[model samples]
Target: MSSGSFIMSILDEAPTLAQPRSTPKHEFKGHKSNIWSFVFLHDNVHIVSGSEDGMMCKWDCDTGLLVGEPWESEGGSINALALSPDGKTISCGRYNGSVEMWNTDGEMSEDILTGHTTWVSALSWSPSGAHIASGSNDGIILIQKAGNGEVEPEVGLMKMRQLEGRVMCLAYSHLGDRIASGAYNKTICILDNNTGKLLVGPIEDLGGLMKSVVWSLDDSKLYSASDKFARVFDSTEGTELYRFEHESFIYSVALSPKHNVLACVGEDGVAQLWDTESHEPLGQLFHQEDRKLLRCMSFSRDGQYLAYGGDHENITLWVLRVIAPELLVRAFMIILQVEKPYSRTLHPCLHHSPASRQVLSP
Candidate 1:
């Protein structure tokens, strides 16, 4: 099937449900400074986070506990973190303008990719696990070969592209052939991964600094989050598709790999979920006070949960639940104390049914 046709089919199957609410399940806290970036490990049972405290640490998802000794970044604070597609290594971008990789198994140094002249703000691993892409405040994007600790800075890193503003975020397309990067200049650039050539943009003039960018699972659309908006654009043509407005500056956006939901968090401290196909708001999960800005968000590979961290030191985990219409109505009724038998029988299908009786039971 053609790529466009395949993407359409995927979008048609994307789930559509009423706005759902999320409940926080776990809170992992330990970082001494703001947690800037994080990514889920391949197993979904662990997560690694980078912090302004100049440390990167792993945590157990199930227990909400630290997994190993924190890796110290002696040069400066860590600004970005990404896991290799094979799940074998973790890469971190530091304020000192260096990218460091560590083996997940032994937590030992794997490689250090250095070339950026300013803080490395973004990092993405190609879906094939063969390359690591990084962006820096120096306004350059670098693609480096993923390897053991043998790569020398002089020969290992290749300059991919240079932009007019700081590269704030980077994401590899699902096909592993293209990359989408957001920059402080309020634009998005699409590049060919293999040849490091521009394919679509400097898609110009977004209203604010582009904080995050993500590609759809089918690689048909690119989504970006910036000040007060999350937008979808045609991945191939670079045409604007939809714009989702927010109450405040948006800090991060994530697309679920297992579901059709797109999640975003912002300065409002509310994590909003939207339907990918319709571009409609789904539901919202509130984090700290509205004054606190949420900086990062990530979805699990299975799409079962979402994790976000921000101005606060603790990381919050939320479970995603898809509720049936009947159950949803019943839950609303119970919460409202609508206990009368007549009220319970309002739905003709539920009249005198065992489910109705169960719902009405004290």
Candidate 2:
């Protein structure tokens, strides 16, 4: 259709695209066991993942090549992973109740941070890259200074909080003022980042066991994933703002840094999207034929790519280009460009082939 015709149709109502099956642009495949957690490097050039195989691998995002040899975790299977805001440091929480640090250049540090009595389950880096907040199966949370390649017996330790159940997930607000944590007790807590003082809850009655939590770009709201729902709450009041229901147990939740879109993945083997402002489900659902239960999810800094893995040995990466009313302002239609196996001419229409989910064979 002509550009003039495209503009008019979009002004009325955007065309709907068919659900997309799992077609990853790249699948990094070095891990020998289930992938547990991963993080995008601050520069958005590389991705680092830790798995049940007790190994951490870094892959170049552009080329999909392993940057170097995988780094073996000293403690045990890694349960959580976090990268410093500056991308200079990597922190991994292990099953052995310990947290270790490594520079992005593949250099492991000498000092190990330890205090939790059981498995270390979650971790988040302070916005300034100076501190780290960690959660463990032992129901303890610690806010400590990040390692600088030296050990001094909790030298930079800041504060600690003991909860009633395993701490499952944590996120530092973009404003750097507070931290949010979700636990097995079905509660979400907000604490002052500096003093580690409880600012909010133990906010109870979330639909189910808390799995993941993240802060809005401005830090005014918090998004969390639980049993079968992805919830949004007011950061200061800890009040429920909205909840998006899922078809299966939701294991992970991620927010686009540059857009108002939230992505979620779970047991159904589908990745779903929701508009943060409208809280309405998007038209596309990313799925795979194997139906692996996805336990981890993350969006790149620019909101142009998404990565997820779990119950599988490889991490899948997708290129996402979203065209929507909120983003374009003048455009009424929502168009999504997900890298596919076959190339097609760029069209302005809203409908696309339903068979766009074929991944390129490795």
Candidate 3:
């Protein structure tokens, strides 16, 4: 094996510390207004955020430094942001009822898309990076192609749907075959992306206004955030599976892709982590103050890092330690399995050999 691989193997066999507690790793500041949405890029090393100040900023996760000058949006206060699957571009939703796309690798240009009649509140990119979905207060959802350049405002476009109430959040399934949207009317809708048919919901009156919606890694379950709780639902049956209680209204929920960790942040000023299968609280990460609501949270694709924004104008990054303890135990077991037979052959106590029996007969 290569020297690097050998070193890594040695490190893996070493006794690891207890689940490493999360600490405030880095803080990205300078949003003049509240940051409404942020997402980690696919590379997991960069984060892009949008704010009510009409600014979109990118940051390097390792250094907590701004990547470039903040990009200004002409659509007024930016409300939501989503990164393309390849991480080369980002889409921003604004209060002016427009969705804009910018190439993150090049100069930031206003590739404005005008479609929504009211403020655009939610934006999500399809898994395949082919389409971008935007939701607005006008009760409309628009799915536009990724490289469409610029678009003009139209009431009923080719890929548009008018739901019951103002759409507040949107998420695309992992397969890119369906879209789930949560609205101001306390309803969650799952629509077939190909046929534009309502597939699952109008999951109405979910205890409070639906603030956010996310899909499980396998796309078999849906998790929604709302007043005082985050609820999980079976994707196929549309039945409630579990309801996670929160101290205050939940603003966002994120599921780890590589582990069964579920994280939620909200009005309580605490980011809580949970075991998705056991329904047990794993840990709580508190903000600087106790009353400021956390507005948005996201998990990196690898599930090793988490990023959240709040009313405090700063975005906080955390290193999630959910899998460390388990890994440590597994490493110990592997060593034990390999050494057990050799130990039994050398140690008489492990086998009832005649000499061992005679010695023990005393």
Candidate 4:
């Protein structure tokens, strides 16, 4: 199973792996309502979730410990949640147009700032953890600076550029230099962090509403989902590099920190694992029959664990290791070739003149 020509030798061969014989490694049970907001923080040691039960709780991602008493939030429906890069500060946004920023010490700022008029759909902190960004269904995006003393978002900046529709998701790149947001207007925006300017042409999908958008570890490309296909796009040029079709709408997508493997969770209760470099699905994860319909999925920072759960009120965590490919690339193609321009004479319709007997160009 080793050779310098290994990749070339197995170009036409498919990938094979030992099948997993057991159920999902861990099944956490606690939430009485649907768990819609889930995220792993502090290097995946802790997981935070918010639900329709009007409460947010933190859990030990490894052991599922209830870190603290769940608090009833003012926002009736928990729309989104975020943990600072340090995992010390957590923020919860609600459907009732209010946001609460909290920490392990308790509520840092209660009823601090509010007014979106709709659900707060997405939230993320800058990589440097200096500022926080939130997007909402009302189409307003805000950037707020954490308070130093006993204050709540004492300093903040509101973006003047509106996406013209509801904001679906927001993400900050690993480098902290760029931020990407998907909107209901059928477009995704990659913005320059320094200037707060839109950089890339709005990335759009055919379905008109993107499910999610995430940046690869190196920030070289972006993985996006729409309808039934997961697509990888060049982060710089906004050009699609690969398109992998799924059986149903992709609920979420996760890329390993090393940027070699990807996991896609679809609406049909199937978790798809793929070799990102080759753009091929390698394995599939199946949940219990009635527990399928996953609404979210996430991978730890180290890529050693994958966790997913949904309306079933349970979180399933799985353990995995990346297996080095024993094959080599025998076939590869570069898509840099330019396409030929239109040639009217090459039309499929036959054209003949009875007088000159020469075909005329349309």
Candidate 5:
């Protein structure tokens, strides 16, 4: 087929567009207090969230309804959550400095693990699913066995390290060989996942308190959100690569599980998407007018859905497939011909506005 014919055929396969609405597709209502954290299950349809109300609830994103009974936290104020790689287990960190594990089958089997003396603020399950890492307000990060609730000094507890500030966020590298952590002291650290040795930092002098950290899919770079900027860094050298600046303090940063898009929300209550490769805004933005801060967010495994929550009692799920039909088509084009340059003028369907056509990145 001629090159023009091939491009036309690809555009023909683009899905139909729905009238975009500024409102969220689904607002999952259950938590009575601020929603702090959440994660999408491997199925990509169910999402589990933890909140300041000390409850963890699972919701079916497709139906916008609760999946089963909400699990009450033994420790008050569940602060963070992580799901095992197999998706069968979810680990919850609470304000009481304890980590609780539950089976996803709706059976509330409590394998409570305790060590830190204050709030457990962050949790990350190793990509291999063999270990769970919990970070606490006490400035400690503990690695323990995921099975049988082992924290025994000799058998279950694998490694532990103390940081200079309250650990705010933690994320395991895709390769599971390292962990990147952000702390309240305005520092970022990369530690060897097995030995608990600091491999890269206490890399200090970051612009502000580190709010979130995530590794590139290839594990070569790390991304973090702070006061007024989200930065890119070399995962191995601990060097800054670039930054995305915002008008307000950034609360969270999430990379799509299957795409090179990065999504972040801030104190301005506006969520922005960016091209991870080019470090440019993707033109699609979601604004939450009711809330001043969007504290947390997660992307579905398929990269077609997004969930974000904050000071409000509910989480909002955005169906990207419906909200940005042309954006997804541009994403498809990027994946297919990343090396080729294209004219800035977008297809007629994407000509809704000059801002919407920004996804036609070269």
Candidate 6:
């Protein structure tokens, strides 16, 4: 569609390679510090990014334009941010080990989640958004109940669990039930959010710090990238599927809406695409720099755009190709992008919806 775009930044956008990754069609700028985290929300129109800049910015994903002035969190470089599923609230992690919640619709701090001894590096919310999970450099994952109308933090819906190392990346299943977390210790821990028990992992495959984790759209399985390659696994069986190796350190990986595609962005400054079914490595997607590290990435809610964030602090959002439903169902309801608009659970392409409670792998 549109031509490449630009955003005047704190640091000038560097010259990119002569090849295809060209210029970011859109660029969102504001973070004063390194931005290693970002998440999409609101029909994919908005993006919330946290940075060492001591602020979290909510911006227009389409134009890389600020929705309003960046919100001041004051806790210091906010490297972790998660938007509630309902799009009503926002959760941010600060450098000094504190997690705070903001009413995104209202733009105010309504809940404060505290407990870690180090900076909170990753955070997530249950599908229902009734439960909030935050992990920190302290090597602990704090589970908190979203404050029920200003109720005391104790009575609020929350819980806490311990992990082996600095918790870095977190993802909930499509159904919003199970949470798979990646940590600095190179382990991916799959937990039952309701039971609050370690269901799996220290299920290690991530060779480096697991920077990003995500499940298929239906939440049956998971895929994670640890700076080396993106690995796919059966969330139910705890089995490895495929490791899409990277040319450089892979820092972020995202699954398309149908779960048939995996896009992993590497710090080596290139992003690779893989066929989830064949487990074969496709080509790569490069960005503005020769080897500048890209910190985060996500597929748009509509599953048509692939966005990546970098150490340079600018975000690159790309519109991508689409694939229709590929499901061949067996039990309950599992929604997917069908070729036609007929509405029953379509063919199961490769979805990962974990919140359905019990998941069975084919």
Q: Pick the candidate with the highest lDDT.
A: 5
Residue 145 accuracy (lDDT) in model 4: 63
Tens digit per residue, CA lDDT, model 4, 1-362 = 43223422343242333323435656777788777677777656767777877777667766766777776756688878777888788778788876677775446465344657788888888888877777888887777665431212422333424467688888899998888888777777888877677788587654747657889878999888766778888889998898878778786777767446777776787777777876755545555457466767777776667787777877777765323221111111111122123122221111222211221211
Using TM-score as the measure, which candidate wins?
Answer: 5
Q: If scored against the real structure, what TM-score would every candidate get?
A: 0.80, 0.82, 0.82, 0.76, 0.86, 0.76
Clash numbers, per candidate: 1, 1, 0, 5, 0, 20
Write out the backbone clash pairs for model 3. Answer: none
lDDT of residue 306 for candidate 2: 88
Using lDDT as the yardstick, the better of models 1 and 2 is 2
How would you encode candidate 2's per-residue C-alpha lDDT over 1-362 as one tens digit per residue?
A: 85445545543453224333435678898999988899998778799999989999999989999998999856889899998888788898999988899888778888688877888889998788877888888777777778642222442232334356788898889877888888887888888766667899878888778899998888888999887889889898989888898889999999988877898999988888888876766546776668899989999987768899998788888866432233332132233223232124333332233322221111
Over 1-362, each residue of candidate 5 has an lDDT whose tens digit, in order, gives 75545655555554444334446778889898988898889898998988999988889988999987898846899889888888898898988888888777555555688888999999998888888888888877777777765653532332334356588999999998898888888898898776666789777887788889988888999989987888899999999888888768999998887767788888888888777877766545787768468889889988879889888778899876554555666655664575254434345555554544554434
Task: Evaluate all candidate structures by whole-model CA lDDT and list the values in order.
Answer: 0.76, 0.77, 0.76, 0.66, 0.79, 0.67
lDDT of 5: 0.79
Superior candidate under TM-score, 1 versus 4: 1
Give lDDT tens digits, candidate 1, residues 1-362.
75334433433332223234434778888999888898888888888888999887788889989987887757698899898888888888989888887777536474678878989999998888877888888887777777743332542343534467688899999889898988877888898877666788888888889899999878999999987889899999999989888778899999888667788898878777777766656544456753477899998887777889988877888766432223333443554464443343344333445644544465
Ranking by TM-score: 5, 3, 2, 1, 4, 6
**Per-residue lDDT over 32-148 for candidate 3, one digit per residue giving the tens place of the 0 to 100 score:** 888899888888898888898998888998998999789884679988998888888888888989778777753555457777887899988888987788888888788777776
Order of all candidates by lDDT, from best down to worst? 5, 2, 3, 1, 6, 4
- Deviating ranges (above 4 Å) for candidate 3: 1-22, 149-163, 322-362
Model 6 C-alpha lDDT per residue in residues 1-362, reported as the tens digit of each score: 11111111200232211113344557787776677777777677877777777777777866679887877856877778788888777788888887788766437665677777889888888788777777777777667777742323432222333456678877777676677888777788887766656777667645687888888877877888885777778898778877777788888887877446788777777776777876754333556565678887877777656788777777777655311111112111232222223333222231333311122243
How does model 6 score by TM-score? 0.76
